[model samples]
Target chain A: MEEIKKHVLDCSNLNCPMPIVRIAKTIRTIEVNEQIEVTATDPAFKADVEAWIRKTGHLLISYAEEGRSRIAIIEKTK
Target chain B: MEDQKLKEYIDALVEEKVNEKTLAFQNQLENIQQQLSTVQVRENEKITMLVTSFELDKVIPAFIIANGAASFGMDVTLFFTLWGINALKEKSIYKGKNIKEKMITMMLPSNPKSTTISRLNMMGVGTSMMKMMMKENNIETLPDLIDLSIDMGAKLIACQMTMGMMGITTDEIRKDVDFGGVALYIEEASESNITLTF
Candidate 1:
């Protein structure tokens, strides 16, 4: 069986600097090639998570609005 | 006999000396009075108060000010609201494990949860490490800090709207807190010259 290529992080209950902060912490523990999915409810996370991806050299895979929240997926680039 | 008495009395009379004083004394008195008037009504500047909503990195500066203001004799208030309320929580007394974690949270962009983990991670081995470090460093735990804040008359209030939305009752807040509506905080902010949101 192929290794699990992606992991999902549900950070909907958190506020600003929280979703990205937790994602960053979770990312630090993950394998180099694995990707992480971040689901957040904070309206400010759309801009912040994207900004973090851009600034930290992470791959912005996809971001979509699901129901009342947003799902953002970022792949570790380095 | 009357002529002899008049001569004797006239002989006893003495000449008076002429008094000498300068108009400069009057000028000196006027100058002293003018100087005294200028010295009396001098004013010290009115104090400024700063109110802040706490975040990890966002709140450190404000916390420094809140603690330091008393030292400077300036009035400072930290108004915790929403997620900002976490800073005042009993669980938030943790510092980062390493110097890097400390500097990152204290100086750079960092979150509250990671800060707790990082601080605990650095303490020593496991659960006991934090307690050991607390003892070794002579630092109070989060609960102690909260209690101290209460004893010191630091205003710690829960946001009524946030509590209602989050389904937290007034009892969930620290018993020492003075709870009320947004109007209370607004009244505080309006009274304060400076209001900050984090």
Candidate 2:
């Protein structure tokens, strides 16, 4: 599905937990059902985000890799 | 008439059994909810640190750990005693050109910035090299971590008895620090889930 993104959180050059920390803070302002894209360089970004999404009941629209960077889109479900 | 009494008695008994089963099921659901609530509380657990190491390597790591936990919304408390209080001091009590005090200041790190590693410090050269390495790796410097800890709400506590024993005046240390004693540290640690001594 082609999901239109409104917010982008660029966490490039950030280390583990920083990206996740920023996402936790940023996701609060987002409206439910609207998609947000998180781009990160941390090798553990995929695993961290996936776990957080699962716990928070958010919708993971899709995930893809770009070069050495990891990108994931999530929609706030609650 | 006897048959009617028997039927009524059976109906009453069945109703009581159904009520008891419903109550038991409701209690089970409550217990599951309580278990989930505890998991969420663990994320916001309290962390307490008793930092006594004045060694540059040890002190820097202490700040990093405390601040890192604080970033995740944990309640962090740092109890500074003896040499640990030196990290919180902005200026040494041994200042103003008193020969003996000056010599003591020279012997010690005096402040967080001038701290040297406990081991492998080759006449201060190793410390400078370590700082350079941290920069190259994008790790926050000791001072940066300390500032972040303060800004992000980590409580910094100084031991009152240690200050008196070492002749350190309140004015020498940062004003933001709260003065406490061993008993105070114990009180805070009693309720803390994570207690670390560095």
Candidate 3:
């Protein structure tokens, strides 16, 4: 796997769609192909982010669990 | 008439009927596909709101939907008419030029954050308790939701007629709000697949 440049977004304690919403807001700022590392505390977001990425056609590079939080690296595909 | 001629005539009639039915079926299929395309386009393009109530419960859900739609790249317009117009007032209740307006704003919770719950509001205690519960649960308050919606590109439109009736001038409302009438709401709603009246 190739190394990808990423931006970090903290969505601590924010529920459900908030984490995904924040990711949607931030993804537009960076250029296409650049990834976002979204850190979310809500347990539901593990599935929610995947669902959103699938619906929006964004690339979900990876999703990792760190302590109690989940981190998803999503790449924008133009 | 000869037997061969009779048989040929019957065959032609049967072929014509089949062709007609096939054409009709194809046309119906095309119509259904067109309708589906229209619905899909409507789904992705816009979400418009006709909010007639400023009650915390109503406005909270409205804001949630508006912000959700806007975050997903849909154009969101919230039309505030009637009591819904109150949601556009500034956070701090200022002394109004008109006494009636001033008194009303003052008597109200002074801001959307302080808006009373629509049900079981025990002399504002319910509102406070609900706010506390929301805070404890990491839920976004009404003010936070409104700001997030604005940041996500949702348009807040105040109905001109309602504002006139309530004696609220454009300047009295918050700076971020736009002015509109029924026609504007209709125009926005027409383009939106999801149009809700609160």
Q: Interface RMSD of candidate 2?
A: 3.6
lDDT by residue (A1-78, candidate 1, tens digit) is 787589989987565444665676677778776888888887887887776776567788889998868998788766
Minimum summed lDDT over a 10-residue window in model 3 chain A is located at A46-55
lDDT of 1 by residue, B1-198 (tens): 999998877666522111123456677899999999886754211122232334334544444334333222234455666655545433321232355434333442122232232244444354355556646644334344344334434566666665455334444355666565677776666656455555
Off by over 4 Å in 1: A1-78, B1-64, B87-141
Can you give the DockQ of every candidate in the order shown? Answer: 0.01, 0.20, 0.45
- lDDT measured at residue B96 in model 3 versus the true structure, 0 to 100: 54
Give lDDT tens digits, candidate 3, residues B61-154. 9987887777677899999988888788875444454787667656765468668889878998888888889889898888888888988999
Better of 1 and 3 by TM-score: 3
Of models 1 and 2, which has the larger lDDT?
A: 2
Interface RMSD of each: 14.6, 3.6, 1.6
TM-score between model 2 and native: 0.68
Q: What lDDT is reached at residue B30 by model 2?
A: 100
> Per-residue lDDT tens digits of candidate 3, residues A1-78?
777678999998997558877988898898889899888899898878877776788899898998988988899997
What ranges in model 2 sit over 4 Å off? A1-7, A16-37, A44-64, A72-78, B1-43, B95-103
Q: How much is the lDDT of residue B63 in candidate 1?
A: 47
Best by TM-score: 3
Error of 2 at A37 (Å): 4.2
Screening candidate 1 with a backbone cut-off below 3 angstroms (N, C-alpha, C), the clashing residue pairs are B95-B119, B96-B119, B97-B118, B97-B119, B97-B122
Docking class of 1: incorrect
**What's the TM-score of chain A alone for every prediction?**
0.89, 0.90, 0.89
